[model samples]
Target: MGNTSVVLRNVSKQFHRKTSGPLTALSDVNLEIAPGEIYALVGPSGCGKSTILNLVAGFDHPTGGSVTVDGQPVSRPGPDRGVVFQEHGLFPWLTAMDNVRFGLDVRKIPDSAEKAQYFLRAVGLAGFEKHYPRELSGGMRQRVALARVLANGPSVILMDEPFGALDAQTRLSMQELLLDVWTEFRPTILFITHDVDEAIFVADRIGVMTTRPGRIMTELRSALPRPRTYHDLASAEFGRLKEQILMSIREVIAAKTE
Candidate 1:
């Protein structure tokens, strides 16, 4: 409903190999993510989904074309864009609260401890604030990572397979946690995942990408009513949409193998 928070125009990325020929990761990628909407990028392994996230985060530059956040060209990473990577990336030395406050400290924000506790509570880690990263489970560490990012109050959140490392049950719980957080914060999210079910579960729109030299193959709007539950997956409409997405991805994989 709000303006576009992130935009990619003809974005392409290439990695040069010293021994082998040049490798192309993404080609001619163009997409606009609306503010407060959850968008999922689903693709096969090595299909450049993470590359796209990096570009948006300004962690890596595109070899061709451009990426923009809030109508301005993204040339470097900033507080305006918060990234949650697949790895928790928490500091082992820091407690959960300290890890969440790390960014605020770097930014020289006053009252870092107060801001950190607010976000830690928001992510359901209020009581465990004193625990170090090693003391927490994989999912809890990720929650701390999410809290760290959210505490900064970025306009856009770019996630690259943030839940891919978790077990099925934990992944579902994290999805629900993310949904609750999104409902409250309303930050524009661009999440990357290979799981079709996960995409449908979390996204307002799903973008399927090709195997390599990845490009947006299709954008499917999720018409399923919000506040989604696992029970929705058993419904006829959910099955129909899942089947369609599976078929499309299957074709792309088959073509790549041929």
Candidate 2:
């Protein structure tokens, strides 16, 4: 995937509930993620963080304003945008290698066998190509999901709490693997997570969203050194950033309650 820039201009999303009529999930949200950058969105539950990712991924459209990738308007899902959800979403019947190859095959991409094998190896699933989703561990299934996306040659990778379902240790390992793969592939990423520490650990910049009718409450650049490790989680700098983000979120929650 080539480096691509993502821009959201005054974006708003409204959903109609059967009982509530129209509900605004996001209101006048604006953001920009530069080429090859990792941007994570974190906020209170139902803050529309995933809504932002869905809009950027072209899975849904904003009722107002625009979303563009590399200056082109986003109207629908395309090969240029690949998404990974909290659920692995792999085929039950397909082998790990075949699941990845399915994406390339859909795109009519040549050399899918080689590409599938390459990404499986990249995600540390080199020997599990023949394993089915049911046979693999949670982490391995997520790796397959990731490999499927990477194999598609997308310019942007949209992840919606992809590690949220994992155990603490596996989550940490997946976070580390994600950073390593991001460094190697350099695809622009838009990640949505509830964990503030996870956001701080993996992102180049973190955006805190306001309580629903969500908007960017604040944006913080992460200064923690790269090739980050578990040890870095205990560092003063990491703690400082964590505190800053938590304080911002606490303010949002406090205001809501008041």
Candidate 3:
């Protein structure tokens, strides 16, 4: 991993509407993501968290400023940045194995089947390779989605509420799975979520964003010891940090409603 994985300088995004007028989604958003670190953006719904991810993934262009990955401006989607969206976005017709192999196939990688299987196993889906997305459980399907992105060997992972659809138990399990995968791969991750605990548990740095026309309100470094486990959440220190974040977020929410 390199020193700095991504940088956004004064980035802003505006969506032109036909009747409602221009929608300012992001405003002067500046952020830095260090290599091998997990940085999360947490905010209320419609606060433009996904818009930030879209800009980084080049799914959409910023109306102002710049977004750079590995020192290069992001102009379009590339294999260097892999995205896992809330919707798995898997091909319904393709089997788990084929889904993971899709990126490799697109890149014309030799022996893509072998590489795909390796990633399937890495994400704990080895035995379900032949199963199509519809045949798999929601959690299993998401595992395939995550593996597919990882198989491409992206330097940065952009996740937009990837676990939001799962049930509580499944969500917790997926979080642990993500931690395991992240510990091993150490890819720079920018995860966007509405869940406060999820952000605190998963991120090395938590960025709180204000409501629409969103700008970063505050950034907090997680000083908690790493190799974190569920037990850590019960600790007094964890509770204190969680309280602080909750307070900050609540303030943002309150201000937006007023």
Candidate 4:
């Protein structure tokens, strides 16, 4: 039963300010994500959701406590964890295929070109491999970015509002594509998003964080079955879960104002 993929034990993060003094971003945040589990985090605008991702990605260190993956501490970014951001962080100079091949090259993996093509095709961008980031649409660029991450074959994925910038229709399509890819790869994911519906749609469990100096307020398990579709969003079970999360968020907001 020892299948913990990632763990944050009483983690806290604080930012030192020159004028405002020390600012606490996260406080005593404890979380455990099981191997291959898709866990989503939702919270208020400034509630340290992205900060948590930064810590997990090893872009930043916690002020207190510890962050670990697979029983080992995370001191720096490694090949075991892959990250995707809100903006498609692709190089304009590199073609789609090359961007995907970048990580493979770093790892000195043979057949990198072929591997890149496979992942690009997996993300439905086969013919667009030669297209530069400037030549691709926002959605396509993001697809390339995702292909880059997937090509790395990391055991854990950290996504920070990956589809937040897309339009409604495009975002839904991306969501479907993500679920399909996730079903195939089954990597443990820690997804941070403000959209409750998106969290419920893609995650096995939804973690809600409180206001400033953020900490997980509660975690809600998704009863919705796998191979989920847009149609499932209209189900009674979906509405029930949405309302439950909405209520919790409302409570947090109310507390913040008071």
What's the count of clashing pairs in each model shown? 0, 0, 0, 0
**lDDT by residue (tens digit), candidate 4, 144-215:** 999999999899999999999999999999999999999998999999999999999999999999999999
Candidate topping TM-score: 4
Prediction 3 global C-alpha lDDT: 0.92
Model 1 lDDT tens row, 1-258: 138889999999999999998999999999999989999998788989999999999889999998999999999999999999899999999999999989999989999999999999998988999999999999999999999999998999999899999999999999999999999999999999989999988999999899889999989988888788888888886887788889989988999989
Better of 1 and 2 by lDDT: 2
Clashes of 4: 0
Per residue, candidate 2 scores C-alpha lDDT tens digits across 107-208 of 688999999999999999999999999999999999999999999989899999999999999999999999999989999999999998899999999999
Model 1 TM-score, 2 decimals: 0.97
Give the TM-score comparing model 4 with the true structure, all chains together: 0.98
The global C-alpha lDDT for each of the candidates, from Candidate 1 onward, is 0.92, 0.93, 0.92, 0.94
Better of 1 and 4 by lDDT: 4
In angstroms, the error of model 3 at 100 is 0.7
TM-score of 3: 0.97
For model 1, the stretches where C-alpha displacement exceeds 4 angstroms are none
